[model samples]
Target: MALSTNRSPQDTLKIAQVRSANVDGTWAIANKAGIAYSHDPVLGVSVVSKSDWGRLAEELSSSEFKMVKIDSVAASYGALQVWSVQTPRFDNARAQRRHSGLGAIWAVYSDEKSSVPDIQDFTEPVDAVYTWVDSSDPDWQTSYSQFKNSVPAAGSHPTSRDIARYTSRDELKYSLRSLEMNMPWIRQIYLVTAGQTPKWLDTSNTKIKVIDHAEIFESPEDCLPTFNSHAIETQISRISGLSEHFIYVNDDIFFGRPMSPNVFFTGSGSVKYSLAKAHYAEASNPRLAVNLAAKLNAELIEAKYGKTTARKFKHVAHPQRRSIHKLINKAFSAEVQETAKHKFRHVNDVSVPSALAHYVAAAEGVGVPADIDYAYVDLGGNHLPMNLYRLVRGRGMQMFCLNEVASVSENEKRGQLAKRVLDDLFPYKSSFEK
Candidate 1:
């Protein structure tokens, strides 16, 4: 990864918007932050009917509107629910189903990727999709079928879908190949997984490196597996590949719509913010670990209580505000917190790798008060305990750019009610084509 020499402070004054229809709460948070957010009603409609999503797929395949998939939204759809009761008009109400004026604003502007006529042109309202890049074939539907045959036994694994749903080799290969060929905005690619590898990877160009359970840590739990698989491993592997400070992307992320890398890069001490997702409250740790050596400005220093002259110092002088705890948390782990404090407080100049090492040391039962600095951070939804702890500790506050997209269940038909509502937000590109 190439580091960006154009490190300028991000412009906080600019009016940035994100498309996050499935995550109404995230949109509400963005609105509170004064950022405009839109969500694809089409996705909502599709969740309510598959035919709608099929229509969207048809339009995208035709390149009608320079479509892009709002993948993060799709990834989070399982946790969201459309209330049966009519949603009341309230500022705090979720963007997905509310019926007030602001809700109307969201409804009018949000749209499926293929319906926005100027989506291909960034000069218009900004639009984008996330993708997991790799070098493989463009069509993996065949692999999707093969994956069904290879699923493990049901007793060992508990999933909503049969094991066959995940064993799609063709789909994985096709998706990875698209990443290799289409996404030019990327500077580096990191593949994080504890699952099976896609067969396409065997023959494709190695632009992206894969980091599975074996490569990242000794065990999944030790690695805090509940956190985003890509977030931890990619952050570690791609730190060295920081070509102009690259962006972290998920496997499903794809830019079917038009937008530029400039959308994410703003010359601010690299933009950092939690991505849009479901949120919940958890116990917060005030004494969480921040950069120490960067905090102390010295290479070596004796611990406040220990006899050691000086521990090994690491990294440059800069305070990072993020924490590993933000990634995972255990409700009643005060001992863990004490241990983290001992390590982070006393350690000198901790780099990301060194920090991981420290965590390893603490995990191995070599610390006190049970790591006080190991407080829980938010992980959106999913494994609440895991997200409550591990965090993506970083140098400063993060900036965000969202695409108001919707997430649909795998079994749900796409683009019926959600698409109709989305059409109300943005006219179909066919209007312009006509």
Candidate 2:
């Protein structure tokens, strides 16, 4: 974990004096004046300082810190100060702990521990793939109506929200252009959609391929009029010319900086999974299919595999092996088939892409457990501008996502803000463009 600050070392001490900042493992983050700040940057750590604020930091990490939950504040200085915020902690130890379990699986299989090689240094080309859709497209809007009667009138699967799971703010095209400009080694770019393409996209580019949903869906009965991501995701392996190794991203996701294959796969030819522990005793949101999918992944890993991991994969483009996904689909055909039929997100959906296939690759001695640093902003966020700044600014953010897209009826100012940042980041035209 690397820690960076815009302020000089002397200024860092003046503000709060991060004495013996512990960023070795998991890091931390908190909202201050609507700005997001992650601590020295790692897992579970307390910034020990000689200042009075040091005590406040310790108290906030302790069990008695209830100011954030109740939306109240407490002060101890002459000047009355009010602060109420719930901090988000990062724990890398839990992820590291799984290495032993993964190692045992690998150890029983083979051995090669000489020099560590960076896979990115290799010349083998890797492709970037994305599943994008524009909600406002008349064809798509009409398609949504085709299955409107199947969905309930109201609930978590709301008509106004679920009807447009795939929002097209032109983020995908910008993100694709960023991939072309930043990652020099990034090979063919694949755009998978529900039979829709961005108008701004250059279809004439041979380097780009627009894959239709009808081409990859397993069965004809479950192919058309499909609104389920699980069904769509499960069929990515079936893509005609998809590389043996590729990164799958949603239209909302992007590559913040140039990345090498080594960032994803280790020198040992093993794929890396960016995962976080998100196990729960029981799920409350029944309609949250991604959670259900993660739970399903956990259960599958525990039952068939030799280890137990309650980890959940974040919403980022992940390095996926074509064969590994095929194996996962074969091993869990029934679940995959059921997941495919969901016209919209449902509780029964399985998210094997998150952890299942990656975990299986590890069990078979071709996977690595890794942590990822990425910025994420929901369009509906009040501090979206700040989050977007944190994402594109010179903070060296590598990957990011802009989800929960605003409808046409909603304000387009958010879209403008995001575009401004992207335009500043990648101002040149990519070869993939006309």
What 10-residue stretch in candidate 1 is worst by lDDT?
9-18
Candidate whose TM-score is highest: 2
lDDT (Cα atoms) of all candidates against the true structure: 0.26, 0.56
* Candidate 1 lDDT (Cα, 0 to 1): 0.26
lDDT of 1 by residue, 230-258 (tens): 22422332233333333444232222221
lDDT of 2: 0.56
Name the lDDT value of residue 401 in candidate 2: 77
Taking all chains together, each candidate's TM-score versus the true structure is: 0.28, 0.67
- Candidate 2 runs further than 4 Å off: 1-123, 151-161, 280-287, 405-409
Clashing pairs in 2: 25-43, 26-42, 26-43, 27-42, 27-43, 120-262, 293-351
Alpha-carbon RMSD of each model = 20.1, 16.2
Task: Give the residue spans of candidate 1 off by over 4 A.
Answer: 1-182, 202-204, 218-244, 272-434
Q: Write the per-residue lDDT of candidate 2 for residues 1-434, one digit (tens) a residue.
A: 22245543222321011212222111232222122222211111122222323344454456222222110011111112222222122112322121111100000001222112223333345777787777788988887887776666433234334554566667776677556533545567788888887776779978789998888888847556777676688888888988888888776776654344556766555778877555533546533656666776767777777687666677777888888988888887888887777677666667766567888888888888887767778877789778876665443345677777445337778778888776655444555554
Best candidate, lDDT: 2
The 10 consecutive residues of candidate 2 with the worst lDDT sum are 101-110
